[model samples]
Target: MKKVILRTVFISLLIFSCKRKQVDIPIFSYSILNDSVKNFKLNVNEKEPIIHYEYFHQKDTIKRLFFKYNSDKDLLISNLDTFYFNKKTYNSKSLQFKFYQKKEINSHKRFLVFNKNYGLLANLAYGSDYLFLKDSISEMDKKLLFKALFYDLNKIETD
Candidate 1:
């Protein structure tokens, strides 16, 4: 009986110790009018969170997003609301771009993922409330809240 009790306690301790822990890391995304740098830090992780970022590099200008599931393959631009990319620069200045598959509403702001794109987001200076508009790479930046919005994985190409 004594031996069995000791074994049970040891097993319990081992199982508890081996359990994975969840941590909360703050992130950010942005808008042009709000140029004051509010230090907005949204968090992401074990619990699902929306991760997003704006991209503006010569030709591949975009406002990217990642919904539910910790990680998922990046998607191609299914639709291009070219009202902002003024034929010269990849600028999204003052334009509240919208994103979704079957939902509605234009986005005012928001990168994403720690394991893969943490460095990039961090280099953008650690925040989702950011903007990166224009051909000049003014790098419009801001913070994005992880709200688990609407997304269609079927549209995204799998890796």
Candidate 2:
């Protein structure tokens, strides 16, 4: 009986210790896409929308980021580049995000986040002009881009 209790306690501690840590990044409230583009396209199918988002950071240096939704509206293509003066090194990362129909989120007010294990919630601001621009991004991509841009933009805005 004592051995059984000790084993249970050890198992519980092991489970708790192996749990993943929750990232504590702050969520911000701001439009993530560029709203002033003159030739942005609007979605025509009515059933889906296209998305386009760009991020620029130029405090001590310059950083440019761009994300675009594919024609099918189920995929995202992102291009990011940054320069560091301290290390005199240039770094870039390109990533693609694909959404599963079952994982999309349709909430009115919630930030979009793509979890590695759980996938992303597809909730975008419905009436944003840049988002509605045809050929830009699908409705789902718009939501994802909003969060992706915000995740990086907030870093610049807050600092």
Candidate 3:
């Protein structure tokens, strides 16, 4: 009986010690896409250039930001005031703001793609004239704007 109790105590202490040593992981990545020339493509029906921003979070803190571009572009832009607490519950912590803007040429077409894991958020296409003249932005201009926006978002620090 004493030997069994000693074994139980030792096991309890081992579990408790392990739990205490568990570290809090932070989510560290965040990005914004803002480039028009290199990050944008025109006249290809099958190819579309994409801008990406990645964020990694553990223990509810930002830890890293990775940005890239790909042919299968997946982008998400959100200004949600609260984040989902669970799969259903909502928790308000702070406000978030992000703006996406793009424009192309007069004869070409431009598309804005956004994804939210479960479904598509936005997949907008516009004619070149409307994108350029109406929006007062060229393809080159669009790239510059996106680059600027991405850099601005990168400057934000989440603690």
Best by TM-score: 2
Q: What Cα-based lDDT does every candidate model obtain?
A: 0.29, 0.35, 0.30
lDDT at 84, model 1: 17
1-105 in candidate 3: lDDT tens per residue? 999999999998976554212122221111123322111111111113533333333333443323333324323333321111111111112312232233223
Estimated TM-score for each candidate: 0.27, 0.29, 0.19
Q: Which scores better on TM-score, 2 or 3?
A: 2
Query: Worst 10-residue stretch by lDDT in candidate 2?
Result: 83-92
Please rank every candidate by TM-score, starting with the best: 2, 1, 3
Please rank every candidate by lDDT, starting with the best.
2, 3, 1
Q: For residues 1-159, could you state the per-residue lDDT of candidate 2 as single tens digits?
A: 999999999999986665443332222222335533223211111112334443333231243334444445444445532111111111114333322222343553222333222222222334531222223444465566555544542354332
| Model 3 residue 132 lDDT score | 14
Q: Model 1, 54-84: lDDT tens per residue?
A: 2222222343332332234322122332111
* Candidate 3 weakest ten by summed lDDT: 83-92
